[model samples]
Target: MMATVRNPARDAVAFVGVGTTPYLRDAGGKSATALACDAARTAIEDAGVDLADIDGICGSSVPTVSVQAALGLPAVTWWSNSSLPFSLLVIEAMNAVFSGACTTVLVYHSSLRGAGGSKTAAADPFRVHNASDAHGHNAAMTAESPSGTYGYCAWAQRYLDTYGVGRDALGLVAINGRANAARNPHALFREPLSMEQYLGARMIREPLCVLDMDPPVDAGDAFVLTTAERARDLGHRPVLLHAATSGRTDRPFADQLEDYTISGKEIVAWRLWEKSDVALSDVDVFFPYDGFSIMALSWVEAVGYCQPGEAGPFLAKHWSAGENRVLIDGRVPINTHGGSLSEGATQGAGHFREAVTQLRGDAGERQVPGAATALVTPGGFLWNATGFVLRGG
Candidate 1:
């Protein structure tokens, strides 16, 4: 039995507009700020809302004030610059609209290839100066540090060891994303990736190959949000926020975390389901962050799609060998827009955008048929983990 919890914000706010810049492997000399502005303008136009209507701005990496100024919004009464993974900003903006802090909000997330991203990025003095680890953390990454690559590598090995699964578990995720990407014009890698290629890809970290990791890229994704009532009268079909929340554990540090099972995704899933009328069975599409393929595998279990250690069989059971994608029970599609693995990492912004696109019936070739509800688990199973349930009316 589960205790019923009432959430006033449930279905009160919605995503009315979504926009994206090309998911680029090359920066093309565009700065992160420029990419943000580009996406914001596109979202604003997509919403068909006048500039004066957007009274709030929210995002990650880029300051809210900076985005407001770049877009030349007359003024914004409320703004917030949340931390990485981007879902925090989405929740903040939704609350702001519901609380009367702002009527309509513009949210954006932008990523630039820093010096550490690639040799090409390193050649640019601008990128070099702003260099940080894969996740914008300036810390020196190493096997000694259980964050970024190290954390996932250790967790992946544990999952494999404990479950007696093989590369097929993680490889399916990569192959699925690549197959989906083949139809996504905005994807960074649109070619089909085979299991043979995935297993053969040079190992960056043992047990995790280059294919298992998300590549760094310069990109941006943005959304226009407002009260569900207001959204219904806007440019696109409103994707209501059935639930939105972020999570963290007492052991905030990656090393302090007990193990794979004790982390943020548990809390995120707990709160999300408790607050949502839409259950796991009702979800028409799913987006699990693929910053690391292990994170995606962990999410399906944490969210109750399967029991821990069953992800391998669960995935294998649902995989469409013909299409090379994972379709849950032949009804739901996972990450219709390729996901971070092949779509280029936009933190979790791209995941949300793709969800909204599918919900609004605007995903073009990648659209899930009659997708009405989408369950998105973004960020990692760490301090930044978050979840959202979106339903189209």
Candidate 2:
């Protein structure tokens, strides 16, 4: 059954706090819960609010209860205790906020599994087919990749055949991320990436090179959500959560998708537009998921910023170190914090934290000037996606 639970809208829900453990490829000294607590503590302090006010807590589905015990999380008004992706947790956290069950909400994720560990011999059954893959990145599939080990490749190859997308087009994506990551201090890969390096990178899946996948990393991140009115009392700037949207159909995976070119993330844009007054042109920054490069391009198109099949050219023609027309006259930033592909994946919570940073004007060197509006997205598996358009109002 679908988790279509909806919470009634309040006057407004705002993100008053955000925090994270330093982004690291491997945090050997830190346990996932330790990172999670650090992030949660930073958020609580940043908001200048006490934990007593936060009655609701939602978390990414890692294999631990330390987060619950650490924060003394009360019974979650809307808990998703499954291996659902990060985007789902954000959507559910918003639901709890809207339900009037809690004025302040803390959402967190921490994990060591993502820290470059090889899957054990008796790994999760889902990863059996992907064990021999060049890299472990694609050793599992979301609902979108129904072919299991080969589903992401299947979708990418279809995009190439139908759209005539060349291997160079994929290079364009890596280049965009690499350039942005270079400016991101929190990013793991801060070095410059050339087309040669990206193209020559080990092939993970047939069409997806190593550069296209997110490197495994260990870390944690957290966000605090409360009403705009309540947030006003807090010391931090409140980035209004204009809307939170989730979309899916009753299908199993990519095999059942009606259109290979259109995924659930595209549908999230449609829902985002339906709920907010923000226009596509008004978006100051975009934090679309960078778990995979192809998905990032798809989200750019899905969000209506560019037409379908136009992202390859958009990134190739417009992105450069000193020139990026997409954001602020070649200076407007995207994924300024480098995102999952470069910054390291913290079970998707990383994206949400970056969005908060941009909104709070705390994004250090990569900060977008006068960035009052930002869009954050998390997507995976077929038809499973979440969207948030945050504005500093």
Candidate 3:
């Protein structure tokens, strides 16, 4: 007879461990494959689980076929080779667990674009093309020709003019990230930024300065997920993967959205709250997406942290400790690892690890004390979003 395993409970999958390499827009020492493996090794080790225990691999579509081979996994039963946000990958991991497809799954990604290698007509499983890389009027990416349908500046300009958000508001973003990164040894940018300084920065696109855009980073990050019961056996703290929710807008591209002002963050958050059996006050910290500062603010509101058009004031108080301290009320502290703006974007995996670290109390120096619950939100704005709730077990 076969041994029977059942779902642990309602919202029972747990995040056992996480790891990542120092993010770099242009990493020098290793190829993207090697970088990705480095994070994978750290994650499994952190979990205190044997390599053979991992029966599944969930890889993002970026660095290419080297992940499973590098990790020496038996097979990658579950995987996503699209630029689909990392948040979606976590949901896939949760589904794998729910379906009894794999006991221990590894989710990982590493970007090789820093090498600036040329892309041709060749087809690669791990290197699925993204709209952002499209070419036409600007073969090498000029201001006039958008590489994809949703290219930079087009939506940003619309949002700015509609919201009456001035450049100074955006400057606040660069200043905040630069300051937060200064204290993060793993961060790529460590210098403080002033409003005047941000204003003077090179404008990459209309209404978007060089600093406004998420840096083109070459880095790798990985995390491991399994049932809470398995986690208890592994001797590591089990961070329960309580909820995973995803939402899509009617618009395939940014241009299709009827209201750029209409946010999907609330819809996703609502779904998560409904499924997780948890409430907003239950989360000790938050790790909402930070692809852009304004987007983060938008998410804050969308997720019911505050009312619409009130995020600026809420942020003013919540993140007021000069980017290091968590509010006493924060059982789920928001982005203690400095988020994407400070720690460098790992496609959305950076946010995932930060939330996991907080729950596991492994964030060292940046750890939130007695962090029992955390919320990890990833993905992109005006596109898709994913949220996960975890509690210390």
Q: lDDT of each prediction vs. the true structure?
A: 0.86, 0.68, 0.66
Ranking by lDDT: 1, 2, 3
Candidate 2 per-residue lDDT, tens place, 267-386, comes to 677777777777867888888776777777777778876776677876665565454323533544556666677777554677777777788888777777788888887765365677
CA error at residue 273 for candidate 2, angstroms: 0.8
Model 2: clashing residue pairs?
Answer: 143-381, 143-382, 144-381, 144-382, 324-330, 328-332
Tens-digit lDDT string for candidate 3 (13-126):
778878888786545546667777998999888888777788777777544356877777765555555455687777777778767788888888766442223242124323
RMSD of 3: 6.1
Candidate 1: stretches off by over 4 Å: 1-4, 132-134, 139-143
After TM-score superposition, the amount by which residue 348's alpha carbon in candidate 2 deviates from its true location, in angstroms, is: 3.0
TM-score of 3: 0.83
Candidates, ranked, TM-score: 1, 2, 3
Give the Å shift of residue 104 in candidate 3: 0.6
TM-score per candidate: 0.96, 0.85, 0.83
Candidate with maximal TM-score: 1
